[model samples]
Target: MTPFMFVTDLDHTLVGDDAALTQLNQILTQHRHEYGTKIVYATGRSPVLYKELQIEKNLIAPDALVVSVGTEIYLDGKNTADSSWAEILSTGWHREQVLSITEQFSELELQPDSEQRPFKVSFFLKQEVAASVIPQIELMLEKYKLNVKLIYSSGVDLDIVPRSSDKGQAMQFLRQKWKFAAERTVVCGDSGNDIALFAVGNERGIIVGNARQELLEWHNQYPANHRYLAQNFCAGGILEGLKYFGFIK
Candidate 1:
């Protein structure tokens, strides 16, 4: 098997319930010599979150990391390259609107007013809390900026990725940085947040049946995110995706 690299979302793609390293990691390990597969996490998570996972030994350490929604990139767990569109985040109404909403109503006392590089944003919230807050956030966001996109995942945690800061964009950047051809890259994920990813055609697209409707819609149009799986979530979906992609079999 030829070496193929996978740039995946960490929270849902590679990390499962109990924060267990997805069983997929063991599978990935098995194929390392045969398929030459290397994984890099392209996550909305911050470097601090990555370090915490490392300390807990919960995440499968990746060959590379695309952290903070692609604002930062690391190779060999060391900073190799980075780009900051802080000017965009700072003056942009999206950041300010988010700050305003969260400041006024969010139950979480997270850093919200920060208008600088490395915002260290929070990606999700507990379900009950989210239910109470998202409506207000949406109302405010609608009035302020439509450029930003919000993705709500199962944990009631919300991920605010610029319609631009998608895991897809990060994966594409990583693919070129490592000199890998687009045809050799594969992305697997479930959730509306993952829609932007299928926009890139480098590799196969695998979506689990449990994915959101909006995501399913994107797949229908592109026939790219059309790759679908039966597994539920976490390790189940990832394993199914790998098998469907013939990454394993």
Candidate 2:
């Protein structure tokens, strides 16, 4: 039997709430052994931080990790670089230059250094500030010919990553590498950053109830037959999606 692929975001989707995390852990652990499902985490977190969260929350590690917003990939317990992605992202990436450009915008506060990666830069911005600054930042990126994409989520978090690296692209890469059928893959996420993961057509998607408004709007604008909007939040939502897709009974 072909193994089903379950790719999910960590924060605000799978392991966000303690109660939800526990439920999700139980369900996944049980189904994983019974159904021969493969799990992957497509997250904006770096590998180091991902591990920290796992330890702190006592969460199960995924079979693979798509970290740093898809700029990095790790299998099992080993860290490995996706060189093809790296080469594609290298064209116009100058982290220091991107930082210097954004530093002029006082409204955009730098995120912790740990959040910074070779192919991604992160910042925090208030809703009002984001409204005004994001356009300007886009213009600056265009002017400088930087091949980066900016993703804003939860009204505060702003991530600038390589144009080719995102949760969706990373998930697709792993899915193909593992030989999982498109119809057998399910992705769950709850924020704007997760939009890309859902946007990957042909795969099933779950948008948890607590998802950001931006993501909901995006989903509404382009509804897919395979997408499920769950009434439950986080892991509960994931379970709902799994059942909706007939991955579980």
Candidate 3:
């Protein structure tokens, strides 16, 4: 049997229900032990916050971590950074300049220092104001000739990352590095940012039933038979999707 890659978002998508997550963890652990399945956790959290979640939720550590909205990748453990991925994000990324421009916008409330990374800048802007402020920020960044990508998720959280860096691109990098078949890669998410996860490659997708409006809208726009919209929520939803995709019975 060929091993497959399971990449999932942390918050809301995989951590909402303790019992469901525990069951999913057991299944994943067993799968890894029996078949060498590769697991990855992707999220917008910084390493510090990711660790906190691991402890608080008792999540099994993944083989790789795509954190800071895909601005950083960690392998072996949370402490070991993927230097190559870092190098990729370094090009055309001007964190300070991005900060300087965003700071001028009072509507954008800067997140804590820990949330800000070398290749990603994070903020909290209300949904109502995001429509206007996001474009304004984009225009300002364009005027400065900065190449960056803005990701807004869960309605309020906004992230600015290098144009070449995102959840999908990070997944692509991992797939290429690991030599995993694109069709065998499974991704799960429940928010706007997760849209990129579905867009990147031929990876099968599991969008939880409780997905946010942004994600649902995107799914409706680009319907794909490869992507499964699970009726269950969070980890349970993931289980439903895995079975639907024939990864499990």
Candidate 4:
């Protein structure tokens, strides 16, 4: 377990619609200034979105970003992704599968060329085999022994990676680059994709009230492990989390 580095999700875990910092917000700067504690937001947003947020002051210019769902990595406002990641996603056993899955479940039409799209093509999975993806997506992958990473985002969006792309991996990179101990890292969010990160960083994840029931029911990693917020929403949840951890006075 890490000493204590409070991190959170952006959309609903940290900031609310009123654009106010919930409990999480109040303590971020306070902890940094008063206690020398740091806070971070790990999101699916990309560099472009980060720039937009900086302009609006929605984000305090992240210390680092785990953005673009792992396709790209940026540090100090510069691209620092490992070369191998991009290279692998470009070619893999799952490329065709992901292409087919996207066609059926995703909004974008499945194309052989994912380069033209907003997200980079990490790999293609053969999604055409209809072995009841709903009941046993993981089992199917295991049966075939796929060599890829599967992640879900804020929405029902599924991401395919070459078994190496994940927020945990992204954080591990940032941890080394920044000289911060991985054990000291904590993450907060409200999505399934966030689950992997939580597992790796165990007891360090702060699940919001809006989290799915499966997570809510099973997450006993930390008692009150999840802070129930009165707001039941983003900003409110952030506020709740910050205060729950006593980040704010």
Q: Highest TM-score among the candidates is held by which one? A: 3
TM-score for predicted model 1 compared with the true structure: 0.67
Report the lDDT tens digits of candidate 4 across residue range 13-62: 55545555533445465566665555555665555665676566556655
Model 1, 63-151: lDDT tens digits are 77877655566777665455433333433435555656566654654533321324334544677777767777777667776556555
Angstrom error at residue 105, model 4? 8.1
Which residue pairs collide, candidate 2?
A: none
Worst 10 residues of 1 by lDDT: 111-120
Over the stretch 186-235, how does candidate 2's per-residue lDDT look in tens digits?
A: 99998888988988768989898788889999999998998999998888
lDDT of 3 by residue, 122-231 (tens): 99999999998999999999999898989999989999999999999999999999888988999999999999999987799999988999999999999999999999
lDDT of each: 0.62, 0.85, 0.92, 0.54
Model 4 RMSD vs true structure: 5.7
* Candidate that would win on lDDT: 3
Q: Which of 2 and 3 is ahead in TM-score?
A: 3
Instruction: Show the lowest summed lDDT stretch of 10 residues, model 4.
Output: 114-123
Window of ten residues with lowest summed lDDT in model 2: 77-86
Give candidate 3 regions above 4 Å deviation.
none
Q: How does residue 153 of candidate 3 score in lDDT?
A: 93
- Candidate rank order under lDDT: 3, 2, 1, 4
